[model samples]
Target: MEKLTAIIPVFNEQDTIERAIVSVLFADEILIVDSFSTDLTLSIAEKYDVKIIQRDYEYSASQKNWAIPQASNNWILILDADEVIGSSLREEIQSILNKKSTKTGYWIYRNNHFMNQAIKYSGWQNDKVVRLFQRDLCRYEDKRVHAEIITSGDLGFLNSKIDHFTYKSLRQYVEKLNRYAALQAIDYDKITDKITAYHLLLKPLWRFLKHFIIQKGYKDGVAGTVICFLQAYAVVMRYANLYLLRKKN
Candidate 1:
């Protein structure tokens, strides 16, 4: 059987980190990469026999990428602290370990919950992510806000869902969007000098269509509507960050 390591990165997630840690207890080892959290996140992680590593906050990709090299196992499952894996996914993971298949990665579906509602639309449902992978073959891209894990080989998918508690309220959503917009602005600012009206205008409309219609977000009702609107807002806000950057200089 291949050795399995679970990698989780957390920051100020005192309310959710414990449950996330407990859910993945069956792994051979759990490695937590944490930002300097002001809450009891460290204490909760310590209670679960977790090996903790401290890092300054950056992009999600940067933090997790740092944790990857430190893992003892060749096979690692990367999970966000807010993500929850159900019982069936756990068993499936063990099955894969026993088999030690040659597949380089596995994509798990994420059922996102916001405000106690399992959002069906807004292009948030059935989000598949490459959570399980061979440590040597996979690496995260260097994007600030929306970094993706890129693997060199074909991937597999797990049938069960990983719960993503994405947002609690509108304030939380706005707060996070501001942070992400700042990150995205920095990334874009470095890559390109200026933002055009094309990106500022067309991209947001496309986001709404992609989520609300193409992704069947409309079927998700109010949750989906709100998600699509917020997504469009996020696109607009990213460009707004350009204004901030320009003004500061």
Candidate 2:
């Protein structure tokens, strides 16, 4: 059987870190890459039988890329603090480890939830990520937000899903979007010389329409509608922040 290591990178996720660690206890090694969280995150994690390391917070891609090679095994499973692997997924992964698989990576779909309710739409219905992969065969794209894994070999998909408790409340969701907008603004600043009405107005409106109408966010009801609007707001905030960032520079 092949040994697998689970790498969970987090910062200030004390409320969710323990559950994340507990879900991956099946792995031969569990490595917690913390960004010096000034909370009970470290103390709670210390209770688990897992390897722990600390580093200053940077962009997501860089942090994940730096930790990938440090894993004890070549086969790696990366899980976020807010994601939990279900029993079917765990069994499927164990089955894969018991054999010589041809694929270098596997994509796992996420069942996203907001305020304890499952979200079936709002452009999140088919949310999938390359979480299980060989450490040597994959690396993340150089983006601050929404980084995709770049793999050399062919990838396959797992039938089971990961339960993603993305946001506990509306306040948390808004704060998360605000932080993402700020990080995304850094990348936008490289290309945007100026912000105009098109960015501030049309783009946000289009974003809202794309999600709420085109993507059928209405199907998910109130949560979906709110998420779509917030998504558009995030776009506006991104460019607005880019404008300020450029001005400061």
Predictions: Cα RMSD each:
1.9, 1.2
- In order of appearance, the predictions have TM-scores of 0.92, 0.96
lDDT per residue as tens, model 1, 122-217:
777657888999999999998998787898798998888888888757897889998998889888787665677777789999999999999887
After superposition, candidate 1 runs with Cα above 4 Å error: 190-194, 246-249
- What does candidate 2 score on TM? 0.96
- lDDT of all the models against the reference? 0.86, 0.92
Among all candidates shown, the one with the greatest TM-score: 2
The C-alpha stretches of model 2 lying farther than 4 A from their native spots are none
